[model samples]
Target chain A: MSEHTVRAYDRDLEALDRKISEMGGIAEKMLSDAMDALSTFDVALAQQVVATDQRLDVLQREIEEAAILTIARRQPLAVDLRECIAAIRISGDLERVGDLAKNIARRATELVDEARTLRAIIGLKSMHDLAALQLKEVLDAYAQRDAERARAVWLNDADLDALEDSVFRDLLTFMMEDPRNISFCTHLLFCSKNLERIGDHTTNIAETVVYLASGAPMPTDRPKTRSFGQAEEKP
Target chain B: MSEHTVRAYDRDLEALDRKISEMGGIAEKMLSDAMDALSTFDVALAQQVVATDQRLDVLQREIEEAAILTIARRQPLAVDLRECIAAIRISGDLERVGDLAKNIARRATELVDEARTLRAIIGLKSMHDLAALQLKEVLDAYAQRDAERARAVWLNDADLDALEDSVFRDLLTFMMEDPRNISFCTHLLFCSKNLERIGDHTTNIAETVVYLASGAPMPTDRPKTRSFGQAEEKP
Candidate 1:
């Protein structure tokens, strides 16, 4: 490839990366708003989340189409091809992150009239904050070609898993302590799950970033076990 | 493209499709066994489920590599390129479905000695059956290039969502009625979530198939409202 062609292709790839990060920014806001809606019982914010998911859906398709065109027109070989493929995959995962946020918002809408306490909301915010941070860091790593930064995001995923376990146990305790809490507790449980899944998808994006920087695929079988032993110790 | 090369490319694409379907078949079985482990509280079956997941991961990489090679060498355009790209995306979704099944089995291992009655097991079984069926039908549709069949699979996803909702409500009721059931109930809830996610992934594959056959993207923004309604109903 000529130097000019190479430069052009690089620009295109960078543009795709920027679009993905933009989508990530939107997803992060959706997750934060979902949690905020849960905490404040803001049904309007939840509805906003539901409505804005369509934009994410459209952006996912646009990113995908752009990636496909880049591959076909540029015919990037080996590492470049892999990077393009990873970008496409990351876009899909990020879109799902948005969907999970929307689901959390939906649960918040249901809980608006019934939620009496903010304990579950606090746990959810903890998970959401960590997940969104990981997502942003990983996307930045991809843009900067920083594999070490991506690896750090991968390592932090265990912290997210631990928080999810804590939230699960706390919700279970509340449901068992009072049958009247069942309805609200179940909604909180689903919200906690949505948040945890967002973390998982963020970890997936981090893994993809690592793969793009280093041509080796990450090990899929290594189980990162972080036991939340203090489940019963907290109120 | 020369006619001979075009024919060769078509044959290569056909072979890739066969491999993806074979991978899908194994993933479907893995999901089925995971459900069996959940319903029977069978640790041995759960271990088997975990063991089989490795094969799915291997097959996913193999199919992906093959798709990449075909695209690079043949430079297929338009519909042919779309089909190859769709194969890559479908394989990724299938691999994630396998991961979710393994997660369900992992949760099953924790529930083996729990004292909860088997009533909730039926709901879980129903969900597993519906998701597996949807996966099987979607793979079959992709193999046959039947957009009508693929659209049918898309419509049936609501059944899996309903089953997931029933499972969630049943487990919530169990947790509320007995404090000792909290751990098992939480595990069951995760299992149900995993199965529902697998269903969603299968729906994604079906949508891709529709896109490939019709040259138009499937509508992914129509929120399936019944999922929340089912969750709101009484246990």
Candidate 2:
């Protein structure tokens, strides 16, 4: 390939990275908006978050198309191929993050209708904050190709899982204490699971980063502190 | 490109399809074994299912590497590019199917400890069979590039969702009726959710098949009947 061709390849890859970062940004905002809507019961904001998921979905498809086109045009080998694949994989995870956030926002609408707030709501808020923070860090890691930072976020996922388990147990207790709480707590349980799922997606991005940088496969199991004995853990 | 080059490209694409079909077969077996373990409280079968997930993960990575290499080596364009991308996408979905099956199997271990069986188990078994059937049909559609069959599977997903919802409601009732059933019902709930997720992945493949055949983006929403009123329908 000519020097000019190399430059064009670099530019294409840069655009791919930028598009993925753009996706990550949108996903982050969607999550934040969804949480705010959950906290404030802003049905309009929740609706906006739900509507915005279409954008994320569009961006994902666009990235896939562009990546395929670049591969067809450039015939990128080895690292270049890995980078393109990583972008595709990471954007996919980010898109799911958006979808999960939309699901959470949908739950918020129901929660607002069911009750103003519940006892487990406070715990969910904290979990959401922590998860949002982790997502931001992981996205940064992907942008910077910071494997260590990505690994940190990946390791911290176990903490989120533990929190989720605690939340699940509390929701169960809440439902048992009062039959009226069943529907409400059930919604909250699903919301917490969604948040945890977002965390999982972030970790997936982190793992993709490690692969993009190192050209290796991520371990099947994350370094989770929790035992496998907990069957009621994240779904 | 020469005729020889075209032949090589065809051969690579054919291998990709065959690999995906192999993955789909393994995933189906895993789901079946997991369900069997759940039904019979076969701890060994459940553990075997869990162990086999690693093989699925390896196959997924192999598929990704080979597809990327093919993109680099052959530079597939247009429909060929679409075929390669579909293979990657389908394999990813199949890998998740394996993971979800493993999750269901893990729940089996807990379910066995909780109780031999319960009243709601019958509903769960039916749901599993329907979901498994959907998955099998969708896999066949993917292999044959039968968009019509894929569309049929896509529309059938709503029935699975309805069944899942009914199962969820029944489990909640069971949990509410007896405190001792709490742990057991929770596991079953997660198991049902895992099965539902498998159905979701199959629908994803169906959508990919549509795109590969039609050269168009899949519609964001499938032909879902029930109102979007339900919060827990899908991600």
Candidate 3:
């Protein structure tokens, strides 16, 4: 390839990476705000989060279209092919992250009647914070093509799983103690699962970053503590 | 283009489509077996469902690799390119379906303790049947390239959601009526959500099929009945 063609391809990749960052930035904010809405019962903010997810969806489709066109045009090979695939994969997962945020937001109104369970809310918030950070770090790693940093995030998923288990147990206790809290606690359980899933999507991106950096798929399953009890590998 | 080259490309796509069918077959069986295990508390069958997921994962990776290579070698344009991308997208969702099956299988043992709520079991079973049928129709739609059939399954998702909501309510009632059923009902709830997710993945394949047939993205949101209440679209 000539220098100019290589430079043009580089520019295309850079533009793609920038689109991912724009998505990551908005999704990160959605996660935080969804948690805040959950905490404060801010239904209006929750509504905003729901609305914002549509933008992410549009962005994902655009990214996928661009990726297909790029592969058709550039005929990327090996590492370059992997990078295009990675962009598509990341866009798909990021789009899901937006949906997860919307799931959390929907629960905000339901939490209004459960003021009694406010004490139990702290656990979910902390888990949300962890997930948000993971999302941010993984996207940054992708932007920098930083495999080691991505590996760190990949390994750190165990912490999010652990936190999820704790939250699950805590919420279960709340519901078991009183029948009235059953609905609210169940909603929290769903929301916690959403957060854990968002964390998993981040790890998916981390795996892609690692693959893009090293030109080999990650050789092992994602690190986890196993209490979720499904024996399938992450994609 | 020479007829010979066009025939070769068609052969490649046919082979890829066959692999997806093989995957669809196994995943559909896994869903049925997982639900059977749940109904009978047959942990061994459940274990088999979990183990079989590994095959689906391997198939997905193989499909993805082949799609990338084909794009690089053939430089397929327009509809041809969309077909390759569609293969990748379908494989991703099919892999998740396997995970959902394994998730259901894991809940089989937990369902053993709630014989009294066996009446509640029927609710979940019907919902499972609905989702399984949707999975079958969607895969067949992909095989036949029937966008209309795919659209029917996509629109039918709302029915599954409403069924899930009913099951959720019933199971919660069981747990609230007797504290001893908390563990069992809770597990059932998770299993129900897994089934609902399996339905969602089918719709995803449906979307891909629509895109594949039209060579244009489906320009509207999937149809749904509103009571599940989350404003954002399916993942």
TM-score of each: 0.91, 0.94, 0.95
lDDT by residue (B12-107, candidate 1, tens digit) is: 888888888788888988898888887877999988988887888788878777877787778888899888888888988898898888888777
Chain A TM-score across all models, in listed order: 0.91, 0.94, 0.93
Candidate 2: the clashing residue pairs are none
State which candidate, 1 or 3, has the greater TM-score. 3
> Each candidate's root-mean-square deviation in Å?
3.8, 2.1, 2.0
Model 1 residue runs over 4 Å out of place are A226-235, B227-235
lDDT of 2 by residue, A27-126 (tens): 9999999989988889999999999988998899889878877887888777888788888989889989998999888877777667433567888988
Q: What is the C-alpha lDDT profile of model 1 across A64-178, one tens digit per residue?
A: 8787777777788988898778878789888888888888888878776674656656787888888778878887887887789988888887787788888877876777777
Candidate 3 displacement at residue A54 in angstroms: 1.0
True contacts kept of 1: 0.13
> lDDT by residue for model 2 over B138-160, one digit each (tens)?
98887788899999999999888
TM-score of 3: 0.95
lDDT of 3 by residue, B1-235 (tens): 5788788888888888888998999999999999999888898999999889889989999888788777777888888988899999999999999998888887785565544578778999999999999999999899899999988988899898888888888888898898777767778887888888888899899999999998767756666664542322464
Q: What is the DockQ of each candidate?
A: 0.33, 0.46, 0.51
Off by over 4 Å in 2: A115-117, A228-235, B115-117, B226-230, B233-235
When 1 and 3 are scored with DockQ, the better candidate is 3
Name the runs in model 3 displaced over 4 angstroms.
Answer: A228-235, B111-116, B228-233
Q: Candidate 1: global Cα-lDDT?
A: 0.78
lDDT of 3 by residue, A1-235 (tens): 6788788889888888888889998899999999999988999999999889889988898888787777877887788878889999999999999998998998886567653588678899889989988988998898889999999999998898888888887888888898888878888888888898898899998989999999878865665676643222342
Rank order (by TM-score, best first) = 3, 2, 1
Fnat per candidate: 0.13, 0.34, 0.42
lDDT for model 3, please: 0.84
